[model samples]
Target: MNEEVGSLHERLARLEQLLTAAQRKPAEPAWRRPTSRESRWAVSAAVLGAVALQLLLPERLAFHPEWLLPALELLLLVLLFPGPRARKRRTTSLLRGGGLTLAGTVSVANGWSAVLLIRGLVRGSEGSDARTLLTAAAAIWLTNVIVFALWYWEWDRGGPVARAEGIADYPDFLFPQMQSRELTQADWEPAFADYLYVSFTNATAFSPTDTMPLSRWAKLLMGVQALISLLILALVVARSVNIFGG
Candidate 1:
């Protein structure tokens, strides 16, 4: 009888252990840590888009000489592609710094334009031509999307290099695939395109939609982007409509 009791207890303990391990297994991340760095092609394209948008703006809205900002941005972009033989750590740091600087410069230029445009609108001196106003508004709106996408790509999870190295145990942005791991492949990782999509949705919806911001900085950034988008739509678009109607 005692021998039977011992065997029954041992079986119950073994069963409990299996249950615990099974529960833990499901809690583990479904995706694998990224082994390689993300590609820069998307980022490069986004920067180019921002540059083009800046060029498209009216000369009055653009900085003096109009080409200075884009020229400086292009110069910084060159730093992003260093010599192949450069040390890996140094290269990564340089690329991150250069990218941030380039994005910041674009952002500052766009912001200056936005301020000037708003000032002109308020003073009843700008956007007199509906077509010109609409065109300038579209350019600013698109540039806003591109620059925010760059910010999201560069800041998430301590930037792309850190993300590739698996330094951040948790993501700054909580993508839908991250939550619904079963829906995505094991090797899935967020890329520049993903960030761009997030930026686009946030700008359009004026709030986070599918992918949510998990960090304070992410929330703040999204909020600022939404505010800028709102200002452009409400002020510039409305002014254009008024001009056309009148």
Candidate 2:
């Protein structure tokens, strides 16, 4: 009886050891990293904020229209330019990064134009007529449209190329050949092709898994922008109708 009991105890211990070893095995890597949905949300929020600020704030509080426009323009330029040094510093896929940079530029330009128009309206200038206000709104809307289009285009190109090549799809590493290596376009083709592939792929797929912090921040930005735009639009329309008699 004693021998049998000892054998049972030993067998149980071995089974537990095997289970622990199995549990320690590393998980398989993901086939593809997730997209940055948080970033998209953040961008959307920023756009909404620009619109809201134009619409809601009293002309007095939101003064300095010129400053916002130029600042945004500068930001766009920095983001879009893919100098060799930048490529080395950040391993983002070339095409997607460039596309994003272009989108940022377009957004800033459009936003600045809107700000100028709003400034005119607040200043009570003749240029602040209904026609101008409408034009400004249209321009802002166009900026969003352009950005969306660019995003989609990049996404379309990036997806298939990554899969076909069996390479990691992260933008930072995928499109090195598209960038300027030493202040020349000589190496642009290969880099550009790789970039296009990554951008297209990422656009279609959700950004690789990101922490909740980024996602929340993006949502917050979107909400702020949306609120600002809605308020500004409302005020502008109301003021315009009052001045012009419908």
Candidate 3:
């Protein structure tokens, strides 16, 4: 009887040790992060929805029409790239941050424009009054101009290029050389995070250079387009106030 009790105690100790080991085991890895493609699609959907709402909604219900254009432009930008399946969390976060910032700026500008219109209404200024409407419209246009100009300046100074060709693809040797390792999905998370941090923190000073400037004409066209947009925004606001009598 004494021997049997001792054996039973030993077995119990072994069982406890096994249980502790099992408890200490790490869990399976978390689901892989979404790819860049997924993020771009999400952004695109949000933008398209915003645009559709602006066009379809009543004036009283419209959030900001001025926002629709810039939002669309930003969406087009992200969609241009064929992003990898595995992206870094930081990268996606930064992209979302930038998008949100752009959206907020547009929304605020639109709100201010509406405020001007409302004030005009309270003062019994008719929307048909050219001077009153133009003044308000001009203010809105200027706001958009300033915003777009800054965006252009930042891009010209050193914004990321989606892709480079020929001499335009010259490498940067000034910074410490990162090892050219093929990035796996796991690797993408950290890399994307670092990419996002660098992109936002140094957006103004991150231009890449090569022997030849790619699409110099295209850059000029973009500037022209921004100017055209500002003009259109002004005209539309002026017309809209008059048409709606608000």
Candidate 4:
């Protein structure tokens, strides 16, 4: 019975130590831990979806050479590679640049596609299948979501690799949970999913919700995202509905 009591006391003491350490540096979310799996999954899924969407789009809607964007994106993804461990200085710099470039390219491509889709709808569908047109709009909008998600993930306090290394000491966004101490644990670094959720909500609501953009760049990016999403939803979606005579 004495041994059991002693063990319980030790466990409580260790817990207290950990909590104290965490509180000492609550600002550094990545304080003492390595990058987690959520970051990896988020980026990998974005790349896969972007490539798939490129293939699924109509040849006319895709760039002049349908395979070019996908090939280039695949090459960039390969360049970053995102291996299991930290990379050398030069290599890490290249990977970071390549990742951001790929994300920007994805955003531009999807935005252009949305524009083209809107043009087609306005030009008159005539005998074009309404369902097919609607499908294209949906695909473009979804690609927009993925592209912006990547942007948020990449630009928020530098990229994932930077955050993992505890390099970026500042935040580009101020989430509600961050302001409330009781809301989340000390080790809660914003994951890719958190940014993805931010993008998703921004697209859906056409404005910032709980997460406030702190930097000028973040504000601009969120504004652009909201505008593009509004165009796709208001113009493309509404046009599709009109075509169906609803």
Candidate 5:
């Protein structure tokens, strides 16, 4: 009886050890390092371009100050760019947080502006020209694409830099290339371009195409993005028909 009890405790201890080992993530290899930086230029350009497009939208669809949202977005861009080498320095976290916050704010502003544009168009355009309305719609659609791309770029394992660092063991998105070793280098990490593709595909299809979301937040974000895109597409179509018919 004594021997059996001792053996059972030993087995339990061994099981716990295995479980702990499984829970712990392996350290990133020395040769395979995460990129300290991401596509700052591309993302910055996208933000600036989106701001420019927003400027083209009618005054009624814009924020009260007209320049408020764009000005704030541009300020974030200035903070993000022309800085000391943040990637190699201690300011990495601050820079990353700033970028993420900027993207989220711009997304909310653009999304809200888009809702206003759609509402105006659906409600007899409020005496606005069809051409101007459609142009604003196009700009809003492009802004939607850019904003969500920024969101995906900023997120997914806690942004590109963190992902490259391998700080987060879990993947929020599972891409096909991630599965095939031959498709990429052994130390390959997804970049802003990959996330951009994920966003574009998701927006177009209104669902996951090549990449699958893994986490609850990931799934929810994607679903919300799809819903917004659908509403935009539907409203645009309905308004277009009304414009031609009347």
Candidate 6:
């Protein structure tokens, strides 16, 4: 009886050791690795382009004083860029928060401009000059592309940093290169410019082209972008054409 009790205690101790070892093991990553991180230069240039585009919009279509939104966007960019080398996690969260804030600000301003443009057209209050109307519509269309591109860049695979870290097991957008290792390098991953191209293509085609949206949010965003692009083309561009013809 004494020998049996000792053996039982030994087995229990071994089981506990196994359990502890299992708990200490790190989780295995489900996806391929060695993803190259994207540079911030492209993103910064895109944001600056958005700011310039906002400035091109008509005064009535822009925020009061016309420069207010641009100034705010510039300020956010100034604060958000130059991410710290240390304190990586905290700085990443801060940068993401600031990036989303900047993107949201631009989205709101552009949305406001879109709404006002549509309202003015419906109410017949917008200027009748074809050139000015066309220019403004073009600016809005270009801004729309940049805004959606920013969203895609920031959201795909839990943002750029997350992608670089290979934290996400899957991607939100499926580029052709991701489908096959033969198409590109083993370390190939979507970058900000890729998202921008996707946005531009989606806006032009009013649908996904080569790249496909794999997530619900991606599909919804593309749908909204299509709707807005359609509205700008159908209403604003059409009105400008009619004015020119008249």
Clashes of 6: 0
TM-score of each: 0.89, 0.40, 0.31, 0.79, 0.81, 0.84
Instruction: Judge candidate 2 against the unseen true structure and give its global Cα lDDT, from 0 to 1.
Output: 0.45
Candidate 1 lDDT at 223 equals 99
Q: What count of clashes does model 4 give? A: 0
CA lDDT of 84 in candidate 4? Answer: 31
Q: Please give the range of 10 consecutive residues that has the lowest summed lDDT in model 6.
A: 27-36
Error of 2 at 207 (Å): 20
N/CA/C clash count, model 5:
1
Local accuracy of candidate 6 as per-residue lDDT tens digits, 156-207: 9888888878888777898888777686877787888999999999999999
Top model number, TM-score: 1
lDDT of 1 by residue, 195-234 (tens): 9999999999999999999899999999999999998888
RMSD of each: 2.8, 13.3, 17.7, 8.4, 6.4, 7.5
lDDT of 5 by residue, 125-179 (tens): 5424667766877888888888888888778888766776777767888877677
Question: Which of 3 and 5 is ahead in lDDT?
Answer: 5
**lDDT, residue 61, candidate 6:** 90
TM-score of 1: 0.89
- Model 5, runs deviating above 4 Å: 1-36, 82-84, 87-90, 126-128
lDDT (tens digit, per residue) of candidate 2 on 1-246:
999999999999999999999989674223243322112333334444444444443343333564564456445544544332332324445635654665565455555555665665566652346775665555454444444434433343253234223344333232332233455343132223333333333323323112111234333533444454554566677667867884
What is the lDDT of every predicted structure here?
0.85, 0.45, 0.42, 0.76, 0.79, 0.86
Stretches of model 4 off by over 4 angstroms after superposition? 1-39, 125-127
Residue pairs with backbone atoms closer than 3 Å in model 1 (clashes)? none
Q: Write the per-residue lDDT of candidate 4 for residues 66-89, one digit (tens) a residue.
A: 777788888877766665355678
Ten residues in sequence with the least summed lDDT for candidate 3:
159-168
